[model samples]
Target: MLKFSILKCLPVLAVCALLAACVGPQKQTAGYDYTAFKSAKPRSILVLPPLNETVDVNATNGMLSQMTMPLAESGYYVLPVAEVAETFRQNGISLPVEMQATSPKKLREIFGADAVLYTKVTQYGSVYRVVDSSTVVTATAKLVSLGTGDVLWQGGASANGKELGNVDFGSGSIIGMMVQAAVKQVAHSLADKSQEVAGLTSQRLLSAGQPNGLLYGPHSPKYGSD
Candidate 1:
């Protein structure tokens, strides 16, 4: 009888094992090749002004201000963004696209930077739903070798701000609720909460030692360890 009971439990145990395997974390691949990165060992990075692809015109500069700290904290010298912008303007390059389109060789000659970080802000704004409103920011960054123009590393991050709760209009008229929602939307817009979200996104993309993230730079204590 004991043997028969054990036999009966075999199927249940097998199912549990299968379910556990299905829920387990899958292995991750380090998507970038770091051969050139380690070989060059770049020490300074120039961050170009971000190209804004979203509807918000303020997204570009708002996101740009948040990038330098993370790169500097990750053990690289970041050129002063304001100075870079002024230089570009004096040279007749007024837009991010134009700056990015400038030849990599010319960039190396002009800035003496070891690498350049190009970024794009694809999403930045408050999105409204019936019950709540949330601000979302998404961005992608690529580190390119100034000497060779080869892409050394690429990563992206996205963040959403805490959702604002809807005003409860219990048993209110439809028109009244609509007006309330409109007012809430306007108030949220005035807050510009997306700027906060953009800061978090920039940090995640530029900080090192995260899984599939950037390798530690030469100045970091963990420099050669990554």
Candidate 2:
């Protein structure tokens, strides 16, 4: 009887093992093609003034200021942002829309950059709910070959501030928590915390060492090896 019971469970065990095998981890593919990137071997990058799709007018400059460090650290020479902006202004392309409308060939001709980084800010600043506020900044960036106007790579990232969701308030009462939230709001308003968040977002988008991130440029030590 014992032997028969053990034999009866063998088919069920085999089926479970087969099902597990079928559900195993799937392989992932690198989404973007790097052939052009490798061939171009771009050494200098021009970062454009961000197109601000958010209600916050400051988002454009805030996000723009954060892009240079990450890209430069990624082993590419970045043009002085002030000089670039001023040049655009002198050329009567003051608005981001106007600047973007200018042809990539023209930009390369003027700045002599091998590639350009275009960024868009989709979200910036805080959203107030009935209970609390959540501050978030979201942005997308793309690297385009100035020579060919082909987008070699692109990515996006977001950063969020604390949210007061089902809060215990600890030793403080509801009123105290409200006051604290209000103080935080005031601090953020004065300090423009969105800029800090934008820095984080830029780093995530431009950092070269990450998986699926930009390949090392010719200036980088890992250039061809990457």
Candidate 3:
């Protein structure tokens, strides 16, 4: 009986070993390569108006307006956006696509910036469902060296108003949920909550200090620490 019991335990141990082998050590994620970005070490960033891929006409301006604060906070000098837009307009380069297409050398000469940030708005505005509604904003950005025209860094971020924990319709009847969703949709549209969400997205996309985020600019207190 003792021998049989030991044999049974051996099989159980073998199964556990196999299971452990199957669940091996977690793979570490590869860190972003910042070689180019580190080499460039830009001091000033010129943000061009974001290209709007969405149907919302306000997406470009909304995303553009929110970009400056975060980049400035990251310790880089952000050229005044209003002035930049007007400069483009005066030169007959009113479209974001055209602005982005302008040669990096020309941009350096015109704006006297060390680098330029190009952005695109992929999603914006509120979407309505039968029992739920939410505002979402998504964007991607790239930093390029004005001198070399090499891409220094790139990242993307998104924000949803519902996920931000600000939306609440209460746990109520289905009819009540529908009504609340409708009312919330109308309120969100009127309030243009997508712009608010864009602010959050811009912070995530441009802010330094976070893992895989932009390197700190010279203006930041932690500039060299990164």
Model 3 earns a TM-score of 0.84
Predicted candidate 1 versus true structure: per-residue lDDT over 1-226, tens digit per residue: 9999999999999999998777664422325668888887889999999999999998999899899888888889999998999999999999999998888799999899999999999989877666445678899999999999998888899987753343454547766666665665676588877777788898899998887688888788888888
**Model 2: which ten-residue window has the lowest total lDDT?**
162-171
**Among these predicted structures, which one has the highest TM-score?**
3
Model 2: runs farther than 4 Å from truth?
Answer: 1-31, 162-183
| Best-to-worst lDDT order | 3, 1, 2
TM-score of every model versus the real structure: 0.78, 0.78, 0.84
- CA lDDT of every candidate: 0.84, 0.81, 0.91
Q: Backbone clashes in each candidate structure, one number apiece?
A: 0, 0, 1
**Candidate 2 clash pair list:** none
lDDT of 3 by residue, 119-180 (tens): 99999998788888889899999999998999999999999887666668786889999999
lDDT of 2: 0.81
RMSD (Cα, Å) for all candidates, in order, is 6.0, 6.0, 5.8
Better of 1 and 3 by TM-score: 3
Off by over 4 Å in 3: 1-29, 163-165
